[model samples]
Target: MHMVIYALVEASTKDEALAAGKTVFDRLVGTDAHSCAVFDYYVTFEEEDTSVAGKARWGDLPTAVPVDSDDGEELLDRGWEATKEEFERNLERVREALDEFSNEEIMRDEDLARHAFHQVGAYDGPMVFLYTEHASGIRHRGQLDRILEESENPWIVPADVHF
Candidate 1:
């Protein structure tokens, strides 16, 4: 089973955003980590102010920003301990930015994405949008299947697992 939680946290300042992220990270770690695991992995959030950088405007080209990956390997290899730590750190940074900016706003309209993408992008708003592509559970399930296929572990590989 895959669970995806995307939220628009309200914070008065950039610091508050950081705090909120920390809180979220803690909450998710509890349920996501497997009890049998010796260590936990964490997901970290990274964000930057696009105010002066200029939002991605339609017909406007993207600057030559080097692409980077937070995790060097696939999700299945991100051990539990590392996953938890990374997640908590990401949230804290976002919360800090929230506290500093004093913007307790959330993108109220879901259609705002369409507006921002096609027409007026990123309104003069005090809100910050956050997203997490959680593939850990899916990858874990796949790994579990591989382990079972290779040997006789009581854990049955779910039919839903493609790999």
Candidate 2:
């Protein structure tokens, strides 16, 4: 499954978006940010924010961006920053985990584990205005509303268009 999200997170400063990304990533991957296998689905904006907006085929992903599974992103990101051998080991574990979770039911909207405002990109305030080939989770605005419920953030309540 694939997803697009608009989130208001506590990330007013640079790199703060990583925090928001971690929360969303954890929900989708079913892993925590501090785990040994976390992934970042977001793409960097070249000296800007990160957005988690894309489809992840099992084997098409790069070693830099690991696929879902709770803390895989955490592990992968750190390992990618660490020595080569450690990075390879972490990447191996993440691939194995993604294979295991691919066949399972997704964590669902109820799995919103972070405090932020989230919504599907098609939302046009009370209705879906547009949509794309992003996973078929668009017709469920009610579910999106629940997941994107208001969550106040002081530092930065960053927003995403389709991330």
Question: What is the C-alpha local distance difference test score of each model?
Answer: 0.28, 0.30
What TM-score would every model get versus the actual structure? 0.21, 0.25
lDDT by residue (1-163, candidate 2, tens digit) is 2222322233344356445544543443335444322123333222132223322222122211211323333432332233233334444554544455443422331223111122222222212211111212223435433423442331111112222
Q: Which model scores highest in TM-score?
A: 2
* Candidate 1 residue-wise lDDT at 36: 27
Per-residue lDDT of 16-45 in model 1, one digit per residue for the tens?
544454444343344335322211322222
Compared with the true structure, model 2 gives a TM-score of: 0.25
Misplaced by over 4 Å in model 2 are 33-163
Model 1: residues with Cα > 4 Å off, grouped in runs = 1-6, 31-40, 46-163
lDDT for 26 (candidate 2): 46
C-alpha positional error of residue 47 in candidate 1 after TM-score superposition, expressed in Å: 11
The per-prediction tally of clashing pairs is 39, 16
